[model samples]
Target: MTDTKTVLITGGSRGLGRNMALKIANKGLNVIITYHTNKAAADNVVAEIIKTGVNAKAFQLDTSNTASFDAFFTDVEAYLKSINKTHFDYLVNNAGTGIYVPFTETTEAQFDDMMNIHFKGVYFLTQKALNLMNDNGGIINISSGLARFTFPNSSAYASMKGAIETFTKYVAKELGARKINANVVAPGAIATEFGNGENKTNETKRGLVANVTALGRVGEAEDIGGIVAFLCTEDAKWINGQRIEASGGCML
Candidate 1:
């Protein structure tokens, strides 16, 4: 039950972030979404959210480039103050990317990119955004089920996701003084640009994942989006620092 009411979602141009933005905006909440590269896609999402009779906008952001974070926060602060506001209500660190290279073949550049985008970005962005959030506000970090399972080529990527979950716990502890909530949302085998139709191959091992999933199919972006929206709702105030997997029971 926060008085300051606005939600900022990273990677909100497409996939799960886009769906989450639309859902929250439909509930009459102010939304500020960020995109790494796809401006057109972000604008499209903003348009859809506005159609729901709510306020929503998109800003360009590169999660891997942490140097620009301060400027981004500055812009967000200015926008909120213009509306006679001082703090945001929630933050969703959903911006991330992936590379399907074996550990032995993974280059330094690739490893750095994944770590920067998945872990470092979430860490520093949260640090910067926390000061601008209101009491009882929510913080959600998007994780992957690959962090829990043994997915060979996903070692580097999954390791970063693992770090994010751990970081969420510490954030919850530190931000507790302000009564803000922080948690992790892990999704399994989602049908997104990260590794959907384009990356399909015989060697891409998701057979075990598919066979073990009780839902009998991979997840869609909206599946995770809906869960994220629920987590930020008033009903989810007690949920903090926990990893809630929206995997449809993938691998039990």
Candidate 2:
């Protein structure tokens, strides 16, 4: 097999996902990114990655809908086969939307949305993706610092992240026999359009996040992509089943 590796990431159209795609491509890895709806944005990222002379493609995916996974993998497999690659090297489960509703006010539908997108989808997606991933490949799951610290109005969302963190450890243990590593990258408050631009547009919230962070500022998308990309590289092979919080020491 060719030594060049391929990494597939979900929600790679914009924000941190876009940054991760570019950085992973910087490591000379071919990239396959799944976008929920924004084909224009996904295409833009693909264009950027291809400029480095590496292979890149974008496919539409509704990560919360488990029924769509079979078709998604079918398309992805066809693309990989066309490139003469039977298996991918990395799977980054990073696609999700945010909803900020207080605990008491959070409804069953809201809670289920969180579970479907953040926990259940990731669980089964990785389960199915495992068959197509090569031995010694790595799985990087995007979690949130909210899983560790407390925050109002985040009960539903954060609870699911907590589940994912636990799920990742089990995956690392079970997949160890295959030499496949699974880990979580929990990011702190980042200045992005995520969570309805919670930290990006809210100056008051931004100030609060900066005060608590040891780095004395809210994290940028750039600060995190390299961390995720590094985990996909050779140097990170020894790291497994750990939650690496790239939160700049928030709530310390």
Candidate 3:
């Protein structure tokens, strides 16, 4: 039961990010969330987080807009100054886009889109955020089980995720002096709007993924949210530069 601290989660407007914000906010942490589009949705998430009697707010952010990372960091610093908080305790680099194309059909544009969103964005975002983060703060990059397992249409996505895991290790090693911890969370196929439409997941496909899982059910948003929340707690203070997979043994 560590003292509640501030947490910033990107793409926190809906889907897994929204769920994670709710879970973290309920634990008495101040939530500063970001969304790429849909200001209305971001506002709704903020309202929900506040309903739990915790401090929460949302901002517009496009992670793929890597050129704006510095400006975004400035905005975050300004927000922190307004709140009189010196440093934030957690950063979840959860904002990302998905692409599904056969290896033969995947074009250069498609490959670049996935790489920019998943790898390049996470890389610069963490670099910018580290300066503003508190000592002993935690960073959780959202990877996917595909990083380790082979998936036909997910070559690009999985490759980027693998890159994230490597980046986490490097971040952890370099930031050790500050007591900062960086880690990755690899989730199995979950029911989220990540790969498809907004707020709509492929129920049948998700169920099939669950059937292959040891748990016999697709993962819910809360399933991953809860894990991310825990990593910020003192209980995980010693866990750094590691990849924790919450896939119910999927593909095992």
**lDDT digits (tens) for residues 64-161 of candidate 2:** 99999999999999999988989999999999988889998999999999999999999999988987999999999999999999767899999999
Assess every candidate by TM-score: 0.93, 0.99, 0.94
Considering every candidate listed, which one attains the maximal TM-score? 2
For candidate 2, report its TM-score. Answer: 0.99
lDDT of each: 0.85, 0.94, 0.86
How much RMSD separates candidate 3 from the native structure?
2.2
Off by over 4 Å in 3: 1-4, 197-204
- Point out the higher-scoring one by TM-score: 2 or 3: 2
Highest lDDT, which number?
Answer: 2
Which residue pairs overlap in candidate 2's backbone? none
TM-score leaderboard ranking: 2, 3, 1
Alpha carbon lDDT of residue 20, candidate 2? 100
Looking at model 1, report the run of 10 residues with the lowest lDDT sum: 196-205
User: Which portions of model 2 show Cα errors greater than 4 Å?
Assistant: none
